[model samples]
Target: MRHLHIRTPRRRVIGALAAGLLCTTGLAAPALAAPTAEPAAPTLADGLALTPPMGFNNWNSTHCRAEFNESMVEGIADLFVDKGLKDAGYQYVNLDDCWALPARDADGKLVPDPVRFPHGIKAVADYVHAKGLKLGIYTSAGTKTCNSAGFPGALGHEYSDAQQFADWGVDYLKYDNCNNQGVDAKLRYTTMRDALKATGRPIVYSICEWGENKPWEWASDVGHLWRTTGDISDSWGSMLSILKQNLPLSAHAGPGHWNDPDMLEVGNGGMTDTEYRTHFSMWSVMAAPLLIGSDLRKASDATFDVLGNKEVIAVDQDPLGKQGTVLSSEGGRWVVAKEMKDGSRAVALFNETGSPQHIATTARAAGLPEAGAYTLRDLWQHRSYNTAGTIAATVPAHGTVLVRVSAGGRWATRPPAVELGLDGSPLVQAGRTAALTSKVTDLGRTPATHLSVTLAGPAGWTVKAISPTTAGLLPTGRSLRTKWQVTAPGSTATGSYDLTLRARYRSLTGTRVESVLPLKATVVVAPPAGVSSLGDLPWLSTTNGWGPVERNTSNGESAAGDGRPITLGGVEFAKGLGVHAESAVEYYTGAACETVTADVGVDDEKGARGTVAFEIWADGTKVASTGVLTNAMPAQPVTADVSGAQVVRLVVTDGGDGIDSDHADWADAKLMC
Candidate 1:
């Protein structure tokens, strides 16, 4: 089930922590240690999941669809062996929801759906076990499961369900949060934990309370992994927002317990390959569970490549168990470093902008000991380079450059750290020549000699050097800038095209070094020079708290086209968009839009129950906002001057309260160019 994005009371969180500490140590309140005496965080007694559990979960790709049956699960088990994922350390083949009957059996035990599992769950578990893999199952903490079908959950029947799961040879349990009947979060979860232990099975307990009770602060001893955020959608904005939420809890993750930020979305088809790489890389660096959330039967080769990157996975499964911390974050450029068991550090230079940016971090800053030189191994490209101390790259838009750095030995012979970047916006029209400037800098101590740089684009594109491209010698910290004119073919489609910058130089030891950097250039068609309805244009991206954003309708329910006419305070409108709270719709304006206007308010579909706020963003800056609108209020007009803005974003946020029935409408939305 989808989780609610809300914060727990601070008093509750603090009380829970104190209570958990006391419970774990079995001490009375007065007999506990003083506040100054920092007690060790309690860990699960079961020695399972020494590293974050690597496996597959079917929720993201199939959800509770008809395809999520016994054969599909057995097929996934086969893929784990056939696709080399078993060797890569993926063990669990899990079912998410809709696996059980609507009600318990005569013995008050869960029953596998006969249609979905004709041979029973135990048979499927046997099939997976025969492949040398394990099996995981899902249930909720309440009387009913999360889906609308209302399958039987394991709440009051914890002991019976736990015994049944053990009888079925279950290796893992994903206990979700839904219909929980206001029971104490700790009590409900601790009961299940005790029940699982009593079964004498090593079932990995995944607490899926969605951080509503601040699980990370006190769930170390409760479960193997605890979700730290709401459900994750397969989109760049969703991934980025979840990453920001989970990055602050690095201290709560350790060897047997992890701060789960949900599952992987690498092959979900909702993001680019570059964005998928960043997803995989960031998740790996965070020491998160490497649960593959995509359907394997239809996975593309590229998707499998990202999922099977052993080097990246190694960082996640490192025995050191230290979650990565943010070395630095500024203007959407983040440097995260994780200390490895081998004394090396896995560093990720991430660019969250719309253009390429040069992100760098020093070895000292990455917690490495002082050494003469550092070996920088590109985990994605699988190449090695030597740097004096600087680890940097011109990371592409919505991309990440992950590298593992160690010191000494062969790395003592330093190679020039060539940093490459493109000047100005990398956007051009089809068949038009764009003057692109490539700046190369040497960040090494010794000078680089016989340095030459060349630029290459796609096959149909033409690139001509407009300035000097060769240099005899480049001193330390010196930059060599060259200009080039790149022209795309007239038939070039309106999409992102890749350009490569190759540089070659000689180090002080007379060893030749080569570096290749990739850049992305987009070809766009500006909006027509007139007023146009926003619903008529294609959105660059969208993220919603509930279902898909609807056009010319009210936020009816949780599915697309379930909406009705856009209505606010009983006034119906024929146009504009309808969305839930915490929603964002982004459009590429190409710096051609001047004004955006909309009538905003909470949709009447929720009566007078919803509260929301509408905001207009030009680029990254908020240009206009409608202060807290409720369903009882009439539509309010909002106008924002978005001149010279390359992208315009529409945002709707929960208004102070929680996002319950937060059906917001942007009626009669229009953009003027």
Candidate 2:
């Protein structure tokens, strides 16, 4: 079911998951405080969505196709009850896009498409209710919906539309942001919230702004569930992308307000069955709204299995409603833990890498009570594990191990930590062998001995490598460096290849426990074409964030973004903007060609926030700039007039909102005549 799909805003291509998150934009300009009660609250939130909403959304699976009719809705409603999805808590039968008529009726009221919904929306809602289910509708805050759906948005029609939906027995509303014309996000959203409140409807208001303007900061009082990231597609990469975007905002999610990572992509075939389970597990742990976006009429068995994991669903529906968070990340493994209402914890060992990995952590390390043994239950396999102080798991490539730990038992002794990292640049050009040194450090008191390093190249590609063989004793707090000669094949593809690096060592303590640090080397193959990519831009660096220099060939993260696209220049570039949001890129206007041009815009995916200016610097002086960009504007084609500058310094800065949603992007950024 497809309609006129606009470019999905070319959202960020998520790279590594960052270990930390930026709580606030430390822009030099003070952020304006959230609106106060003197202006009166905009909407009557009234504690809706006490838990993340469990339902079905039509956008991801069937987007405004001719099949998007009342029967389709009724068919899904029947599946909800027949297939036990309703039993597991999925209730809403939603109409996402294309259900609205081309225009409002004579009284400016939204009318259902006559051909598609010959019986009208009220009749459909009544049918859903008859099946013991709820109904949800989709609209936009802008002038029009995000699809070719002919109905006008609820911008000026919010109150009347809200009343109309209420009268039609609608129980949910997904308000989107398209054709919004860059109006102040807070004001516009608040307007619709008040309009819904005026109708005295108990609708679950879902804000679909796609994380622009930092909705988490101000939407707690506005909507029940607000999208904290871009849309989700039925692919592992897209799911992980949305997951990483919403995970760090865990603190803002709760009983009444949850971080919406958009609709679910499970049951879709873009990902494998295992990957689908991982997708559902992570979303459940994050306490995100579980809106199934698949056609139920022809659901697959694997889809049913992933969606019907009642034990996992219990974690999501726990009355405590506390969203899980990443407790510890080592190598490519993450130990995510969530507290349950019954003093229990749901822990997920997630392996984000493409290789099988062994990840172990103590209860204390994962934020559990330092001194208690926990009864662990395997949620997926439906088995129980022996009470233990430590959880050591071997996760498959891009897989997960989710378990529930019951509190109150024995105490655990903290384990030693060994860190393995590369000493030189992680990026290597094709055909060149680089001296890759692995720095192994003992962060704990346990002495390490008999250390060895192993390296593996990409599969199917022959890589010439001379790795370090053996090492002697390394006392606690001591560090050792081993060198490896790694050469990529001359004909290697121009992309990022993970070089598997494993450090094996034994604890020289009385117990003599062995440990292995699974790390990967990210080598960026320069395009055989010769022009440097945006990430490889000579002087591209940011003025913010901590640097593990989260760099790849495409996107990177400086400390500020916390694994988010490098936020800088008053915009978050899903491309690699380095360090902080106020950084600059240095390049020759004639580096690889004649002129350096890029389509620049705020990183708000669509309508970027705040005012941003792009400045071109010459020898210690400013030359050209696209003044301060107004709020909610589209990306402008900016060609810098670097008249006589040799090494041009491109600078971008936040115009006040303290770099709020100022993720600037330079799409198709290149140097050309």
Model 2 per-residue lDDT tens digits across residues 322-383:
88877765444777888889877888988754444555666666566754345567798775
Whole-model lDDT values for every prediction: 0.81, 0.63
Q: Which stretches of candidate 2 lie over 4 Å from their true place?
A: 1-45, 370-372, 409-673
lDDT of 1 by residue, 1-673 (tens): 1222221111112222211110000000001111212212689867899999999998888877889999999999999999999999899999987899898778897889999999999999999999999999998887777776678878799998999999999999999766677778989999999999999999999998877787877788989999877667676655665676677678778899898988998898878899899999999999999899899999999999999999999999999998888877765678999999999999999886656777898999999999877788889988776777898889987789999998865764666667887776567779889888998888765678899999999898999998999889998778899999999998888877888999999887898988888887777667778998887777755666566888888767666888899887778888899887657787778888899999999887775477777888786677888888887889999999999998788887666443446788889999999
Error of 1 at 67 (Å): 3.2
Structural similarity to truth (TM-score) of each candidate:
0.83, 0.60
Q: Which candidate gets the maximum lDDT versus the true structure?
A: 1
